[model samples]
Target: MTEESPGAPGGGRPEDVRHRLVEVFGERVSASVPLAGLTTFRTGGAADWLLETSDPADIVAAVRVTRALDLPLTVFGGGSNVLVGDGGVRGLVVRVRHGAISAHGTSTVRADGGVTLNGLVRWAIQRGMAGLERWAGTPGTVGGAIYGNAHFDGLMVGDMVAEVGLVDRTGSILRVSGSEMAFGYDESRVQHTGEFVLWANFDVAAGDPAKLRAAARESLGFRKRTQPLAQASAGCVFQNPRVTDDSLSGGVPRTAGALIDGAGLKGCRVGGAVVSTIHGNFIVSDGAATSADVRTLIEHCRSAVVDRFGVLLREELVYVGVFG
Candidate 1:
């Protein structure tokens, strides 16, 4: 990571960065943009500069400019699983709106990074493609899911991924195979390394359209019943602990939500943030919840789980900006 320089233009200077961004994006840039309206939680403060781009060329240009200016860059997708600080972000926020999906063949589909997971699944199902139907109700964008290795039923998003179009730190585009990329539960190597994903080509399977639709509907129903979808949450708060051969259940660790609920932390509150009573692993924000409140609740859950089960949980959502 590059450290901000005090003397460099646009380095720690929000106004200069904003000016350059406006100059580059024309009317597409905004200052002090409220992040609350941009996220699922609706609880964050403003961003110093927000650049919404629908064109991949624009995104590439903005990235290049920000890099040359030594400004921090934070990428935004569906904003479904992010928790921005109440104090707001300082540099450039690139919001992707490149929603496009095209079927290449009976078993292949290419979608822009900004296309939502649900939308992709629906598109696949409509075309009688089978593989993605299982992910119908998963939130976030195609790029976000691919970056996070979003999974269902022992299958990860990377499994269906054929190739990923990525923009590296130097703004060069490259396509990488899913197998070459390291993928683990709830995380991908690209995500950990902060590589910007542009799009993905998926190799799906052919199936009956009705059957695929049914599968998608069933998955969506399951998600609705189990997850706190009606409330504001970033899906699961922690990744499930890695299973060991000597562990209980012959090696499989219990789900994080079950463990937290077993630890008697469900519905626990810290300020306006609370662990969802319906789902122990989900932290939801009330109308008055702040980023600090959510952080406190997360810490409380982590401590309680560690004390009870000797398992340390890792956060699933990425935190952006300064919270204090």
Candidate 2:
């Protein structure tokens, strides 16, 4: 749909979009807001219109309001796994912040979409819950995790999901079974349907809180030792390649980082963006990087890998808005 009014001159005025959003969100809606602070990358321009809310009802209402105005909508969770454009985004950008969580009976846990994955892991552990403790240092909110079927150590968040409450593009809410999500490696039904996750139910098992906490600490320590958590990056830049030819690897591990490292692309730089030496799969910013710089660097790495090995890498990172 177009964010333009046929009746207005010069497509629609920005004020018109803001006015309609203000009607629905009052002072919660803003204009020309900087977006870099919301993402893990800490790069990007601003949103022409922005809405921050902690209510699931507000998300549904925002959908209706934006639809009525014929404007586009972009939902942001904890702002990990995304690269917003330097030119900024048009229309309304909604940031979900509702993070209420609860436990039902013995083994079921319900959490709002805005709850951080790490937070959920902690909450589950404190209650002697077993399943989520392994995802201790995972970034992003529950909604974002569900959207991408966030995985770690061969286990996907989708695997533990029992059901999810979703708000579709037309502002309709529905509960769907986990199987209906069509979750695969870095994929989900929400990516195709443009649906928003309101909350989710995870089927977990009761376990020892001490054991769960220890597992969580181990996970965190592993991340710190291997990944570039000290740098400004969007986690892993590329997804691990699926090995097709056993001879192609030559001896290196069948992983994205190993492929990049084998290709001798570590520490490769473009502008202020550099491939992290600690982890070949990560592209880090030196606090002076632009979105354009990072995008260019990513392309360079991909091209290098393609040249060295016939494998074409896939990115796990999501790009938002327009790139210039």
Candidate 3:
């Protein structure tokens, strides 16, 4: 291991701490790793320390060491809904790679936090499960989906979540039940609490194998038809504003996408970032889009909607690093 630099924390300098982490993680640890490769936007700079942990024990150790050294720690899952800054992260970046999925019972499934949403969907479909069919086309890991409380057709991932295993700030693991999670529309108590999800269990219903497969295919097809799946985006940029109870009597609730499209903000661009013409809610990064570009487009879209419809839009994706 490299020797500690002068005047650093935990009896070592940042470089020494990084070296120690690399020694512990072995091949999983990388120095000055490219953030572009770690996120969906594919446009940010490198991170000072990027540690990939395939074991839950390693994850706990990484967190403990970073906290002990007073280094900032950021957890990365599938990286589908994040925009890393060009300046890169100045702390420890822990990427979960311990993806595994297992059938707990005829109506239950257990998945590691690193398991991709698509992977979980496929696993469930193969077992004739029905509840997760709606999320067939969503990107990112199961943990990210749960953290963001992702939803479609008024159904949310949290609704199926039966239990979640979390790592607290002090490196203690806690298992929380569904009712204890306190989920809201596109939001969860996990965010405010700063808990790191290690794994989750989902409750699902049994269905015909052929029918479940068809549902998965149809759901994915609908997503491809309506969303810019080929482009670089963090899914929906804004949460849909709530409709009055009276509005529910006539039709479905009003969505931010519909509102933005109605306000004529489709194809809107700020630098290389553009509101996807295919899906007004998605802001796509066209090769060279920066975090600033994405932010500018988000603000512009919100401003346009507010000016035209008198509704203030809320963000769906959580901005991290410098942007946050």
Best by TM-score: 2
* Count of residue pairs whose backbone atoms collide, per candidate: 0, 0, 0
Alpha-carbon local distance difference test for all models: 0.80, 0.86, 0.80
Give the local distance difference test score of model 2.
0.86
The TM-score values for the models, in the order shown, are 0.92, 0.94, 0.90
lDDT, candidate 2, at 4: 30
Measured with C-alpha atoms, the lDDT of residue 208 in candidate 1 is: 94
Clashing pairs in 1: none
Put the candidates in lDDT order, highest first.
2, 1, 3
- Candidate 3 lDDT tens digits, 49-156: 787765666667877777777777788787888878766666678887547788887888999988888888888888888888878888888778889888987789
Better of 1 and 2 by lDDT: 2
lDDT of 1 by residue, 1-324 (tens): 232322133454655655676678888787668888788887777766788765666667866887878877788888877899887776778888657899887778999888888888888888788898899888788877877888876889888888888888888888888786687788787876677888889998889999988888889898888888888878888887777623335422387888799889998998889999998989998768898899999999999988887778888888887687
TM-score computed on alpha carbons, candidate 3 = 0.90
Model 3: lowest-lDDT 10 consecutive positions: 1-10
